[model samples]
Target: MAKTLNPSFSALYSYRIGSYYFHSNNRLFKFLGSRMRMKLIFKMNCDISFLAKIGDRLRLPHPLGVVIGAGVEIGNNVIIFQNVTLGSDGKKGKEKSYPKVGDNVIIYADSIILGNVKIGDNSVVGAKTFVTIDVPPNSLVIGNPCKIIIKN
Candidate 1:
């Protein structure tokens, strides 16, 4: 009783001749699917690096011009707009710090979320706002210092 290989895996692993073309085709299809899914997911996770960790529930209106730094932790149902930067504050020895965002967070266009700050759940950061500090849950923040504009 010998174990049999799966057809797709066997086809992918067996021959080197047709396998190249076959795998290429498969990879092309996979890439296309990932791209389309990325677009859709971006509508929901704007930052690719962030999506890499959180698994694409975060939507980005436009992924372009978005830079999500390493060590950033994003929660579920997050929506980010275009031209957003989520990164470290680059303060004295703060280059390694990353922002931790909570669930249902909505960050608008051109907003910068930086430092070792934690944005609470259901919070919204308005466009062009710069946040360098922590935000409470269910708060709407705007402006340079990111004062809480409203609480939900």
Candidate 2:
């Protein structure tokens, strides 16, 4: 796993560096720490902290205004759209509080999943929704207060 910083490669390669720097100690870390790696991600108009626990196949379709908290844990096959905020529930500073999204979840644009809520597997969070509570599995959550639309 010797990844050299290729000068030819642009900032679009941030995901590889962002995912790698967190869980391992390589030449990448020696060259660039978490802050620097996250900086690259920020350049892509997303603020996903390297401290956040992100699973495999994490796709950010429109990465702009996507603010993922340091405490957030995103599961596999998660497709997050633009202006999505996976962060704390207004608990002020220095708090380990955020959402834990499950696998195969499709979070649409401008949605905000806050607090320590656990979104179940195969769930779909609708656009511009404000979620602060735990959602059941295979459900579709929508609206400001979040209406649970159960899916089979």
Top lDDT prediction, candidate number:
2
Query: Model 1: per-residue lDDT, tens digit, 16-95?
Result: 22323333558775455455445433543333442224423666545556677757888888887778888877778444
**Looking at model 2, which ten-residue stretch has the lowest summed lDDT?**
1-10
Q: After superposition, how far is residue 46 of candidate 1 from its true place, in Å?
A: 7.8
Q: What is candidate 2's lDDT per residue for 25-135, written digit by digit as tens? A: 687664565655656555666677767888888877667788888889999998988889998887667566889999999999999998989999999999999999999
Minimal lDDT window, size 10, model 1 = 8-17
Question: What is each predicted model's overall lDDT from 0 to 1?
Answer: 0.67, 0.80
